[model samples]
Target: MVLRSSFFVASILLLTACGSGGSKNDSLPSETPEEKGESLYVLNCASCHGEDGKLGSSGAKDLSVSKLSDQQIEQIIRKGKNAMPAQEAVLETDENIKLVIEHVKTLKNKP
Candidate 1:
């Protein structure tokens, strides 16, 4: 009876630990501005926005040399517009959002 009880407790503990969402996968990728922006952009924006961020999908506007200021770009990213999905939640941090705007600024116009 004691052995059976011990085994049951061990099984319960193992199950609880295994079921816990303790994996590092969901944790933030980077803390620094550049790293944070690069990581977020790569994961969320690369598909339609392109790796360079200027080659938008068909109707999407080119971000390079955009007339918008960084604040405007950041706001648009956070709030989204038209077909674009709001990213305030996905970008997570304000600093990181700013970082993304800064990175986007580097996407200079093509010659």
Candidate 2:
């Protein structure tokens, strides 16, 4: 009887403790634009362009020395250049593309 009572008490305590933490989804901040871009880049571009954006795995351009403006970059991303395929299908949305473009700018080697 004592053993059963103790188990019931412990189970209640464990459940109460679990519920005290509150909602995990509310605790986390929404993904920032740069973070969103980094994730997308890793999924889509990092294989060829690399984490720093200069790997050029298959004739991809060296992004560190890239001189293209945001507009130019957008065009290239959507239209494709040389071995790079058009990203319109992959990127899907303008906002997604914009976030990636901003992150890519941060990769350039500053003069």
Among all candidates shown, the one with the greatest TM-score: 2
Worst 10 residues of 2 by lDDT: 20-29
Model 1 earns a TM-score of 0.63
- Lowest lDDT sum, 10 consecutive residues, model 1, at 21-30
Which ranges of candidate 2 are over 4 A from the true structure?
Answer: 1-25, 109-111
For candidate 2, give the lDDT of residue 17.
81
lDDT of 1 by residue, 52-88 (tens): 8767884567776578987788878999889888899
Question: Which of the numbered candidates is closest to the native, going by highest lDDT?
Answer: 2
- My TM-score estimates for the predictions, one after another, are 0.63, 0.74
> Could you tally the backbone clashes for each prediction?
0, 0
User: lDDT of each prediction vs. the true structure?
Assistant: 0.78, 0.89
